[model samples]
Target: MTGTPRRFLVTATPPTTNGDLHVGHLSGPYLGADVFSRAQRMLGHTALYASGGDDHQTYVVTTAQRLGVDPVELAARCNREITGTLELADIDIDAFTRPDDVYRDEVREFFAGLYSAGRLVRRTWTFPYCAETDRYLLEAFATGYCPECLVGTCGAICENCGHPNDAGSLLFAESAGAQEGSTTEPRDVEILVLPLEEYREQFTEFYRRRRATMRPHVLRFVDEMLSRPLPDFPVSYPAHWGIPVGIEGFDGQVINVWAEMLPGLRHMAEAARVRRSPRTPAGVWAADSGFELVQFLGYDNTFYFSFAHLGLALAHGGLVEPTAIVTNEFYHLNGSKFSTSRRHLIWARDLVGKYGPDNVRFHLGLSNPEHQPADFTEAGFLETVRTRLHEPLQALATALAPHTGQPVTVRPETEALLDRYRDRMRRAYTLETFSVRQATETTANLLALLAARAAGDPGLAVAGLRVLGAQAAPLVPGLAAVIESRYAAATPGTVPELADLLPVTV
Candidate 1:
């Protein structure tokens, strides 16, 4: 282990207050951040994991209206559901602050400060107005019939026809689920804009520097953003649904989610400071904080999370900058994007209800979609549960249980094997590389080796099992107790050879 552990600020926004979290949510930044935070704690580091419910978006208000309840009540109900779901999945968030409640003033200051400094500008742009919502549609809701292929779908671009259309170019639906009887409307609204053009050269340099210093996938994203046409749209909306802009003239307007949402990062930074121990490292609060801020998110949020938000946060704030933005591409389910509307996604509740949190945790670690789109199939779920969680760990526990019959000597080779596992885990957790496949592969190889070792040599196998049973005891205390009770009276398995499990890679 390293001499001293590094402090971390791990932050992610909870799913929309109106939406239920699915497997995609589990496998995305939230899961990744949870794994990273847990690993940091395991390594004896101070890691602050902060998350908050997003209750200010138009979707939340519209969803609430459809249910014939106030948006605040609906947001509260959904927040409760979200908290329950995450807790059941063992997502132990250190702090769960609601954006609308605890972070509103912070977000307001963020907007006003930027605007007063001339960093924020205003512009007019066309947006899709939903009669049902009585508000303009955000990018997430706007969809149309494909003028090319004529397939009406629920995406900014048509999936069936593969064509792109603006709100005026196609027939508008009242709600996302709006049928033929759905109401439609178009309204022009004035919105405040964040002028990214002024910072083009600065962003180019910042992004290029980030690309040069970061992992390859992160670098690729930097290159993509640098080459894309700059978005010159208003960062604030004339709608009453989001965090209100504090500018004197923009009372009714709310800072759009993109520009306003990143204040959540700073809120977490301050919260971490408040939560940190007195002896905590000074860099955690230093103006030029050396600690990296790694943001995890899905591919759909790449533009905002990967580039735009990072740039905005760095440009607007003074404390810490986003060092590594670790965004996964996506976790697709059933050959399509995991959608709450389509019911194609697996909710965390269902999985947690069936098995347990630890089991689900193992699956999340094994199936992290850090790179390209990864599939989450029922077969994959069953296989991971059986092989990775149930069978292998159970086998190790059983093999080690009987070895404690006496004060057994710790074998040097066995200790070395445990050290190897520790080192691999440390690397995977802190190295912050984009190669999750490699991490899982290494974990698999180690587990397979342990299983084979348990099957083979008596003395070394027993000692190895004992060490694993010891190390994992703290993390999974219940499983540890079970292992100690059952295996302490038993004996090690007798396979012909020990070399089968402990292979020399060199």
Candidate 2:
């Protein structure tokens, strides 16, 4: 927590508004971004955390169809659910935007600016069409094996390999809603595309300059992408669920939802900035805005945030290039991926309601899938809470309750513990080497250390308790606030009430 104060605009990839968020969703970018932002504030830095519901994804349309409801209505309903879930989980987002008329106009204007600059070009590509359903099979509407990993997946992107599969390019692609044995036919259509191959050299150099700070897995993925020919990214699609392309020829088409992500992020950041400084001018996206951009996303979205989005920023004359890209692998439930279609997952609100938000946050931080896939087993969760958190917290509270207002000099052992804890926090919460799991471990170690020494040296325990209140502020704000408030009111010959510090039942 000892660094030069800086300004950061931290963003989590907007959650798609097709349904309420599951634990897998909370454990990924959302919780990570929250922790990172809180840590930054603890360091006395300016960090604005911004995200919103993605209302334009094609999944919204498909889910709405399955529920026999209008797509717009379904998106609105899910957006409310997502907001409530975030609140329940104690995620402090500066701006959780939902697209309004002004937002729609801004997106169209941004796309048109890129188009007018000749950064986007028209291309003819083959698309899969289902005659029976009268629908185009693209992005959540089609299914097949991935070209790279050969794993069964949906169109547009492969979760297994973190690679993009163009519409109809998947091996043996078929319409998702087709009846048994029914197949899709190929249809050629003209749409606008971004020629990523044109920016290969620039992207290679951009990533090379950032090699030291970027994740190793992400670097490998980027090297693989640059070694092969970069595909021309589609910018427009013939669909009805997103913002209109607003071009003359593409009448019935809308801008691809992925293509709109960069603009959406920009709009959200601008909204946050305006809210923070009402007199600041709007629509300024220069690189010298004095705010560093850092984005958090899942590994499945590597191609978009690192490559496609970077390309777009470069093409627009380098407007707000990300200073850091923090990506996490998928969080699994019981050794299986959480699937909304299969209904095999735990809801965020449900988990937070059962176990308090502080415990849920700590548990998720301990099992965060940063380097590799991690599973959430109920038994493991219970054991971790009981041993790592509940027992240690209870013991510390009991030992400290008797001598709450006693004058205590800082012991040598307590000083050493505080120094090591601060060092660990400094390393774990940084943008270059961020790890929620490490942060959680640091907290657990400090708690265990303090609890083990509580009865022997009451004065040392008191000093360590002060350090714990500050160290746990970012990870468990609610509990930290209670501890800090009670100790802040400490006086000579006063015994504070600390019985409510026990862990909530799971």
Candidate 3:
């Protein structure tokens, strides 16, 4: 364990409330953040993992319309489903917040402060207007080829190249809700925009300090974005389905959902703090709070978390910027990206229900898509669980079944082995080079080694099992709990009872 303990307010990118979470979603920020936070706690630190449903995204409005339901009702239901799915997947989020009156007030105050400080500028921008839908084609309401990569993509951000496209900037833009061949006409309107070019120097200095630690792919994306003139990020949009901007001369506009992200995170953090300590006042986001911010997100959201959000925090005085940003690549299913619109994915709840949470978490962790796109196949998952986890665990249990209730003293050799494994885990869980896949592999290797020595050196095996239980707690929490309970008396350097054998299956 580290000699000094640190405090961390770890956050995952909030999932949009348009639909239920899928395995692809769980495999990215949610699972990664949970494991990282848990590992930090294991190292004797204070790590509060928090996130919530993105209830104000345009996707929610479009999905509600498609389903013939009220937008508020749909968002609420989806939020509940998302919270339940996270719980089922064993993601222990401290605060799963929903957009309430308090949230809205906080977001409004944050935006108003930025505007008053001259960080935001009012300008006339052109946006595509769909006559058929009688709405401006922005965000989820629009679809076109990205301006940079020329890949077919939705508005706002391109998942392929990690670039942002302003409304009406997408090539061959068309209304997503309109009939085939339906086109949108350009309409100019006054709105608030953040000219990112103005803060180029600040962003450059910030990224210069982070170059060594940030992921290569993420750094490449940032460098590519900084190579050109930064685009104007719209802060407000003309709409009626979201939180109203409430700024003068923008009566009909609402705050852009992307722009609301940083403030929303602050709100969630404050909420978490209040729950942890009732007397603690708000403003835990202050830079002097001593809580290092660590953000976990996917490659598609690198721009928002690393750049856009950083700009917002800097512009807002006294707010803390993220100290570390962890990103994962796309997790695919059957060689294709999981898409709710295409309905080509496995629901997280279904998998957890069928295979159990620990089994599912173990598979996802072993195959975590950290650097490149990783595919999820049922056959591959089943094979990994059977060979890598279940078989070895069962073998060890069988060999030690006869030794149940027997007392054994841990050996010096066992301490050295445990120390080596602990070192591996410390490396794997390091914030700068964190890897769930590596951590999972270390746990599996320890289990295999223990299984091999179960019969010959039962004392060493039991002691090693104790080490494995503690090490695996962060990755496979449910399994670790079971292991610890069964081997409760198998403490290192002491003669203790083995109690009972491991479960037949996990």
TM-score of each: 0.81, 0.96, 0.96
Which residue pairs does candidate 1 place in steric collision? 192-234, 192-235, 193-234, 193-235, 401-487, 401-488, 402-487, 402-490
The residue ranges of model 3 lying beyond 4 angstroms of the native Cα positions read: 277-281, 489-506
Candidate 1 ranges with C-alpha deviation above 4 Å: 65-68, 100-102, 128-133, 145-189, 212-218, 276-286, 317-319, 397-402, 434-440, 466-506
- Give per-residue CA lDDT, model 1, range 244-316, as digits (tens): 7777767677776656667766675566656654355534634466566766655545556654565565557
* Candidate 2 per-residue lDDT over residues 1-506, each given as its tens digit: 46588878889999999899999999999999999998888888878888888999988988888889999999999999999999998898888899999888988998899999999999998898898777788888888999999999988999888999976679888887779898778888899888999999889888878886677789889989988999988889877779999988898889889889888988888887776645655643568777778899999999998888888888888587888888899888899998787898999899888888888888999999998999998788888988998888788779877776566556676678688888888788888888899999889888898789878777666666667778777788888888777776777334345556634754
Candidate 2 lDDT for residue 363? 93
**Poorest 10 consecutive residues of model 1 by lDDT?**
497-506
Ranking by TM-score: 2, 3, 1
The 10-residue segment with the lowest total lDDT in model 3: 495-504
Candidate 3 clash pair list: none
Kindly give the number of clashing pairs for every candidate.
8, 0, 0
TM-score winner between 2 and 3, please give it: 2
User: What's model 2's overall lDDT?
Assistant: 0.84
Question: Against the hidden true structure, what lDDT does model 1 obtain?
Answer: 0.62
lDDT (Cα, tens digit) per residue for candidate 3, span 1-506:
67778878889999999899999999999999999999998898878778988999999988888899998999899999999999998898888898899999999999999999999999998888888998887888888899989999988999898899877678888888899987778899999988888889988998888876688888898889899998878889987877899889999899989888889998888777766645655666789888888888999998888778887887776898778888899999999999987899999999988888888888999999999999999999988988888887777777777876666666787899899999999989888778999999999888888888888888777778778888988888887887776656454444334333333344
